[model samples]
Target chain A: MKLVPLGDRVVLKQLVAEETTKSGIVLPGQSKEKPQQAEVIAVGPGGVVEGKEVKMEVKVGDQVIYSKYAGTEVKLDEDEYIIVKQNDILAVIQ
Target chain B: MKLVPLGDRVVLKQLVAEETTKSGIVLPGQSKEKPQQAEVIAVGPGGVVEGKEVKMEVKVGDQVIYSKYAGTEVKLDEDEYIIVKQNDILAVIQ
Candidate 1:
């Protein structure tokens, strides 16, 4: 979907939770908590700095690791998404 | 209680949740969710920046706003606390 971030917030598309268990048992979504993994789809240019410009360190399409409980949840067009700031991001996976 | 931050992590002392409602009705802890406000107690020097020094913007004793679900929970001496990186901090309230 065409989702745009507001201000310094970024939109993340969550990755699906693991379905197969170590023993090869398949678990359905109703039986497990949602995983926190995500793929970056959009990001703000950067946060404002003293009326100056500050470019962002991360770009779109980067896989990132973030706090499972971090960011505010939002649902757009029946799709779940998260809104987090750059500072809330822990690290980016190459 | 004395707490120390490791690496780029910071320690925060949580603020007490409001007891009185907007209409002055008293809500007890068991009936309400914990508030997410905190006062900074300690901070790491800074995150690694190309092996160079980068001082932290927030300082000790600064009141901060953070994600309600951010950080790992830890209990020291029966007191619950959170361990979060500097990046997890949203903003410092001056």
Candidate 2:
């Protein structure tokens, strides 16, 4: 399903948590923990301020680092997705 | 600890999760679940584009709604904090 964010919010499909341990030990699927990373899939037009539109700084396909404890979890078409404002994004991975 | 975000990032101190059930049954401290909410404490100056500076839209003390699964969790002087880009913020709750 196509997920669209309202206003200046963006919808992100989370990147899967790592499956292997630091030592390269692969854990079973049942025991894998969720990864705290995501990929930007959709973005809103720039936020509006006093009748002027602020352009978005990030674009689709930017890999960003975010806080692990932010954002509300939503299940869209059985796929887990996250919605956050453009301002909440920390940094784009180069 | 005072957190200064780099660039257009912000540091948020999470609000405590609710302690009472929908029926008003107060859960014990040991059994309380973490709430998916936070308060804006600090923000970065606007992001830079082409060496020009932009101003931040949100300010300190704004209650914002965010995604459940965004941001990096950090421990600052024993307090838990989340760091995310300003863009990741969803909306300001008035």
Q: What are the models' TM-scores?
A: 0.42, 0.43
Please state the CAPRI-style docking class of candidate 1: incorrect
TM-score of chain A of 1: 0.66
True contacts kept of each: 0.00, 0.07
DockQ of 1: 0.04
Model 2 TM-score (2 dp):
0.43
Model 1 Cα lDDT, one tens digit per residue, B1-94: 3444534667777765534445322445564333355788677556443333456777888888665443654333355455566667787766
Judging by DockQ against the true structure, name the best candidate: 2
Number of the top-ranking candidate, with TM-score as the measure:
2
Query: In model 2 chain A, where is the ten-residue run with the lowest total lDDT?
Result: A68-77
The whole-model C-alpha lDDT of candidate 1 against the native structure comes to: 0.57
